[model samples]
Target: MVIVFSFRKDPNALSPVNCWHLILSQCRQESRDHGALSEIYSNNITLRLSHINEDVARLSKKSKEIGVQMQEELLKVTGELQT
Candidate 1:
């Protein structure tokens, strides 16, 4: 038996950190199930870890993009005021 799990990023969530914690909790519960014990659990854990990594990467990229945009806007405003 094989079980695969995929996680999607939610833009409206509080933050990736919180979402990752939620995922971890869910995975832990799933792992505790005694009905079946096989490679699926290991696979699921790996998948969850990968999802968390991807989420963190995406969040970091977005943060950097927003920071750059804000900096540019501030520079533009400062330039206009000086002129």
Candidate 2:
């Protein structure tokens, strides 16, 4: 949003059309920067999601192991009670 105008010591130098061109160039550069930032943000989100999926898979496997152990313990306790 900031437009910088550099001119010689002469007061009446550049025309309005030239100034507009400079402004347009600056806007184009800003737009390109915005696009690059968006791409970076999207890549970061994808990477985080991939890591989260890995963690979820690991936790799920651990949970299944615990469930099996608990079931075995429950069966052992039940048999002891019946005896």
Candidate 3:
């Protein structure tokens, strides 16, 4: 037994090489755009984290100062009562 295959040339059907080339070019462009987007996302996240860290540091410093003031006031009041 013998098998035969036939191919027809249609104007609408792209050649294999042309199809592959077009697909590769489109993929390259999409990859470049995605890379740029990823970089922007990373930078924005870093900036937000840095801002949050600075706010935490400032709050901690203020809390310590308030605590010290309270301790001093308490000590003065107790000393006067003991006299």
Full-model lDDT for every candidate: 0.87, 0.93, 0.95
Model 2 spans > 4 angstroms off: 1-34
lDDT of 2 by residue, 6-81 (tens): 9566545667877898899999999999999999889998899999999999999999999999999999999999
TM-score of each: 0.50, 0.56, 0.55
- Global lDDT of model 1: 0.87
Q: What is the lDDT of residue 13 in candidate 1?
A: 65
lDDT of 1 at 9: 79
- Residue 10 in candidate 1, Cα distance off native in Å: 66
Residue 36, model 2: lDDT of: 95
- Tens-place lDDT per residue, model 3, 24-49, is 99999999999999998899988999
**Best candidate per TM-score, number?**
2
Better candidate by lDDT, 1 or 3: 3
Residues 1-83, model 1: lDDT tens digits? 99988877777766879989899999988877643555666778789999999999999999999999999999999999999
- Which candidate comes out best when scored by lDDT? 3
